[model samples]
Target chain A: MKEYQKSKINRIKRGQNRATYDVEKIDAILDAGFIGFVNYIFEGKPISIPMGYGRKGNKIYLHGSQANRMLTSLLKAKEISMTVMHLDGLVLARSGLHHSVNYRSATLFGTLKNLEDDLAKEEGLKCFMDHMMPGRWDGIRSMHQEELDRTLVAEMTIETASAKIRDVGVNDEPEDYNLDVWAGIVPLKQIAEYPVSDDQLKSGIKIPDHVMRYYEEYKY
Target chain B: MKEYQKSKINRIKRGQNRATYDVEKIDAILDAGFIGFVNYIFEGKPISIPMGYGRKGNKIYLHGSQANRMLTSLLKAKEISMTVMHLDGLVLARSGLHHSVNYRSATLFGTLKNLEDDLAKEEGLKCFMDHMMPGRWDGIRSMHQEELDRTLVAEMTIETASAKIRDVGVNDEPEDYNLDVWAGIVPLKQIAEYPVSDDQLKSGIKIPDHVMRYYEEYKY
Candidate 1:
């Protein structure tokens, strides 16, 4: 397994036992979620904004309007960090101190560069859409040149990444286990509901295979 | 409606139409989730970490181990920012440009201070637990003095916050709307499954009302 070299900045100090530097493990966590919180320093204050992203190998692609504040600030700063997390379950323990949540989270740090060329920017946008819903770009209306002109695309090369995962049941104090209190995991998940077709959709236009597949797999 | 005064830092630029400074709306968004992405600067690189929080009026409370890195750093920095987002649905459109997600998100900026006294810390911890699962603090075992001492609780005074919400359906371009393409909203929600009691739980002790209520309300 390939591991990201641990540095002073990326090391996990408190929960070292739950942390992993394995590249594949980190990437798997990233792929499971399309939304990531992108951090940027604004007026000397750090702020995070949730943004849609696509990952192709070590490069993460992000796009926003040309005047997007966070994207431009990140471009100026050169380096950026993004975090993705999925809450799996709620761990309710007999004791307050032992209450926890099962989750898989990944944090990535790297340098970001704007994709100025038309082809690169187009590809980046395609990746962004396809990553959100696989095979979504194939049948969509092609982008006009003016639309592409007003979009800013960026690519970040992952320099170092770390993933932390907790999937076990409740871990309570040994003595508290026998107490007359319930302890367990309340599994949580994000599921899709029935699709509501657009009111103006042309009659008889059926949902495509990719769209149906996403709904079927995610539906509760 | 009371509104957070618009400022250069808190204003939304890109999706200005969906932005609101209404205090009640922002608080509603905050109350829907207990975990927030907290931004902190480490070695000059801005990074985000998911932290559990509780809100009371204008003050937000957070707790972690006494040696928690993020909490200590935020206390030292004096000011901090955090964001919470709930994805409502996927807006599939005829064109990629019009694809988006229906969501309610809030970003809060404030100054954090460590709660030094035992009473304040205890209240903060209680708020944190109750916020995650309502009525959860009462039935659980009380915290011991040593446990309380080993925990670090911080209270942030929310100075300004902003929220953006999008709950509409597909928004394809006017020209593209008539195309023979499917478009719609695939609703998404986070839900809880049936509770799984701990293996070592003393048998015959039924799940309490609080747990049952939580599961009933959240189960998909």
Candidate 2:
């Protein structure tokens, strides 16, 4: 589908001007970040926890220890909601009411299922690792069978999603724009610095190409 | 109290070794970021929305338009849960099972109250703005009465909270340390670029000291 069918569940009500349901746009926002805030009901109250995720087509993969409270709770509920946001810049407006941040955020609503099959579990784990840093999965040692058995992998089939993007500069009251106040945007970015090699690395083992590639792509 | 009293509600189950209920540590995590992922129940499902917030003592302030659905719903629920997380670095391990990210995250559970008084509302708004950038509230034009009237401010008195911090280097299995794989951390940072003046700024108005100071503090 080109756009998610907007139901009451996934629709964006506030700041509708910044909302979008385009499938590609929402996917772009999701692909831009690996960590998402996943929410589940706990003790009759909703709580969000940051978790790493991987997306393949409409399915998002999440894995944790078998006893992970949040993941197990989400599984029991059989549904999930995840939000990923990237703060791009701070919009310094001429007026207090107009001050805002430039950001791209997407919220996903989906149903979840467990990846119980061993091969499927491996694939899910690989996707999760690669999503954090592409090709890092191949560079790392394969997970031992015991480690895989202790992990719980959940797959979320995204049913609906919406994104809100605010990329513009200062937005102020037209009259206030003429005031003697300075206004602008302070662009923000998440960057990577040089990698620190592990102290116990095997002798003569250089940093892998995949790790260097990730650093090159994100380094300032 | 120096620490939040932990109950089943705020207890850390999975990563107990990394969890903290110390009030000061949690406050530091909250102060380091202006945006929080706030969760609320809608249609029996939990959904998280990213919102800007300010912290004062044990109180957190959130503001949005009067018609903001999330704020209105949070007010009606009379309780709230918000999570703030700052990603510190990528921990690349020699094994996929050991891969993790260094981060500091706090989750707060609180009761919400609307700031009905004009002065309280103004204070809440000021806290929100200053949290984004220190002294930003004074740098901008004051809010008009009409603007204030259209805003909804909610104060959350935090009753309990928990934080998890992971700032250490890669931890690989003892046996894996001898493997021919490189493992380490890639430091990550969110930085500010030089400010760009708004196109419609009033003539001869230079960038304010507060704004320049923020840029200087966060710039690469």
Candidate 3:
């Protein structure tokens, strides 16, 4: 398995046991969710913003209006870091110190490049839309030239990454297992409810196959 | 309603229509989730880490091992920023540019103070546990003095904050409303599944009322 070479930058120091540098594992964490918390230095202070992203191979794609402050700052900085996490469950333990959450999280550091060309922007946007909902790109109306012109798309070539996963039940101290306190796992997940069609949609338009398929896969 | 005074650091530059500085609204967004993405400068580069936190009034509390690199760095910096976001749904629109997500997100800028006293630490830890699951702290075994000594709790006095909320339905372009494209929202939510008792729990110990209450409230 290919692994990202650990450096002082991407190394996990505190919870070394839960850390994985495997490229594929990191990619899986990134693909499981479309929203990532991206950080950039703004006016000498760091701030994080939640952004929707799409990944292809080692490249992550982000887009916004041409005047977006965060995207513009990221481009100027030339490098960025993004994190994605899925909270799997709550680990209730016998002792307060031992309580934790079961989660899968990945952090990525990469260099950014602007997708200024129309073709590149279109491809990036398509990847993004399809990542959010498979086949939705083909179902939606194509973008107009003016719309494309006003959009700014960025491609981040992931240089190094690391992921941490904790999937087990409670890990309380052995001595406390005999205590009367109850402990367990409360599994958590993000689920989709039934689709609500836009009131303004044309009269005969039905929920498409791709959307219903998505709902079926993620529905509670 | 009280409002957070907007400064250059905490002002929302984009999506002005959805931006809110109301303290109540921002606090509501923070209280809805326990995990927050906190940004800090690491080796001159800004990186964001997901951290569990609790809030009381305008103060946010975070605790980790004394040796935690992120927590130490945040203390050294003295001022920090954290963001909490709850994804509500996906907004599918007729055009790619109009696609968005329904979400409630808040970004906070604050000054940090370390909780070194045992009483302060215990109080902070209790708030953290109760924030994750109400009544959990009182139900669990109290923390040992050694545990309190080894834990580092940092309280952030929220100086200013801003939030953006998008809870509406699809807003397709007026001209494209007649198109054959399907547009709508697929509501999304984080839910709790049935709790699984720990394998090591004492034979007769039942799941407590607090755990059952949490499950009943959040179970799908």
Best by TM-score: 3
Which of 1 and 3 is the better model by TM-score? 3
Report interface Cα RMSD per prediction: 0.9, 0.8, 0.6
Query: What tens-digit string does per-residue lDDT give for candidate 1 at A138-217?
Result: 87888999999999999999999888999999888899978888888889999999888899989989888888888998
Question: What range of 10 consecutive residues in model 3 chain A has the weakest lDDT sum?
Answer: A169-178
lDDT of 3 by residue, B1-220 (tens): 8998988998898999999999999999998999999998889998899999999999899999999888888898798899999999999999998899999999999999899888988888888889889999999888888889999999999999999999999998899998999999999999999999998889998889999999999988
* Estimated TM-score for each candidate: 0.98, 0.98, 0.99
TM-score of predicted chain A against the true chain A, for each candidate: 0.98, 0.98, 0.99
CA RMSD (A), model 1: 1.0
> Candidate 1's C-alpha lDDT?
0.91
Model 2: residues with Cα > 4 Å off, grouped in runs: none
What lDDT tens digits, residue by residue, belong to model 2 across residues A1-220? 5999999998887788999999999989988889999988888888888999999999999999899888988898898999999999999988888889999999999999999999999999888888889999888788789999999999999999999999998877778877889999999999999999988877898888998999999998
Show where candidate 3 strays beyond 4 Å: none
For candidate 2, lDDT tens digit of each residue in B105-148? 99999999999999999999998888889998988778899999
Q: Write the residue-wise lDDT of candidate 3 on A73-100 in tens digits.
A: 8899899899999999999999988889
Report, to 2 decimal places, the DockQ of model 3: 0.92
